[model samples]
Target chain A: MDTLNLEGTEDTPKVILDKENGIFELSGRSLPEDSAEFFQPVLDWIEEYSNDPNSETVFEVKLEYFNTASSKLILDILSDLAEIEGTTIVWYFHEDDEDMEEAGEEFSELVELPFEFKTY
Target chain B: MQTQDLILIYEGEFTQDITKAVLSMAERNMDSSGEESSVKRKVFNVMVECLQNISKHAESFDEKSKAKNNAIFMIGKQEKEYFITSGNIVRKDSVDSLKNKLDKINSLDKSGLKELYKEIIKAGKLSEKGGAGLGLVDMARKSGNKLKFDFEPVNQKFSFFSLQTTIHRS
Candidate 1:
């Protein structure tokens, strides 16, 4: 699958879904005013990637701050990953950011996928 | 009034640019004051919800009314907590539902809020404005406090709606 790279903005996260280089990560703040519009391409990319996923997919989510809208879309993205076997989510949060940690935990509980929590 | 505790206040239309500017300003103020990362996240979360809520729902009175698309946002620092307050114009007909939503959120306890959050996200009901109706719940959950709100009638068709969310500094 072709890589889907989107640079981060003040209200959107940086997304890198490069199958060739084996890098799948999203990071930064994600509180776009139009989250659905902002995340549509990402959702589409993930859907296409699902058809021929790698042997083991380790998607990283290193968001500092995301609004509730983005939170729901994050869950959707994780759900998509859950459908693909051999997929693990690497959730990174700031050391003192309890809310982000808890968010990751909640996503782990809801989705049937392995999650590794790391603090930066 | 600009008091020592008053961090920032904005009143006018809520364009995406204006929202970003105000949020960054508040963030800078919080960072410079040496606020803990956790507490700052809570405040930032609540502020974003409040401002985005206004941007999405604030009703314009009429094409010619001066209050069209106008709203107010204020953040202040008290000794023990930070308060984020927002007010916007809304149609009088929409007041009841908005009030009910706030009341329901304020009445819930922590675990109750967690359950509601989970339920709402699972339901995945995204509004036309790109909201899942989770803003109020998220604000309540992040702040860990009851949402305070009021509505004042502006005219027959519209009212001024105000909401306040508080995040403790501890």
Candidate 2:
């Protein structure tokens, strides 16, 4: 699988998913008019990636902000990643932002995917 | 003509800069009072997100009205509480989705919201337009209050979004 890299704009965030390293990352902000359209491909790639079953996958998500619809898509990405065995997700948040930390912890609860929370 | 503590309405070029200036003005006024200052910041953060959301998501109105895609964002305090109001234009087709998100968030309690927000964050997708599906939920949590919104029909296809949220200072 080729690396998927999407740049962040005034309204959207940057997403860089490395296939070889099995380290997929999506950061910055996201809130597009057609969210389903934007995220569909990313999800599709994840689906294909999961099938190959990498030995270990490291997914990193560091976002300053995003919108409600994008929130749903985040779940879709993480849950799909979880399906692949031995995948580890590193969720990072600002040290002071309890909300972001809580968000990651909350997301961790919903999925059995192995996750580690870190603050920087 | 009536004079309250503050009254400001601007449209056209440099709209965001002007709106932010007015925000700072409010902050300066409340600087002397501690509780009021923190509350004002909370309200101000919400107001910024509200305005930015409008600027980022609003479609077509900036061209039609020649407002430069600017929005009307007002912040005022009364009765020991602060009220932040914002308005902007968006395509008719997009209104339903926006409303649904707000409605869903408004309906959830802390725990319910925790679950719902997580699902959206982990499973949700990103749009090219630059949002991660996190702003509104962050707004709701930050304010420690529910978000209030209104969408008015502007044309056959576009609707105006007016969002209001208030913060009380103890």
Candidate that would win on lDDT? 1
Expressed as tens digits, the lDDT of each residue in A13-115 for candidate 1 is 9999998888999999999989988999999999999899898999999999999999889989999999999999999998888888989999998999999
What is each predicted model's overall lDDT from 0 to 1? Answer: 0.91, 0.70
Chain A structural similarity (TM-score) per candidate? 0.98, 0.93
Q: What is the DockQ of each candidate?
A: 0.81, 0.19
* Candidate 2 structure quality by residue, lDDT tens digits, B1-170: 43334434545433445545665666666675454444654665565566656656666564656546656667766655666777777788988888999999899887777666566565555556555667687678767788888999988877988887767765
Best model per TM-score: 1
Local accuracy of candidate 1 as per-residue lDDT tens digits, B1-170: 53339999999988777889999999999999999878888998898888888888888877686654589999999888899999888889999999998899988999899999999999886899888899999999999999999999999998999898889998
Stretches of candidate 2 exceeding 4 Å from the true structure: B1-71, B75-83, B87-109, B112-138, B146-162, B167-170
> In candidate 1, how many Å is residue A113 off?
1.0
Position A30, candidate 1: lDDT: 92
Q: Model 1 chain A: which ten-residue window has the lowest total lDDT?
A: A93-102
Which 10 consecutive positions of candidate 1 chain B have the poorest summed lDDT? B60-69
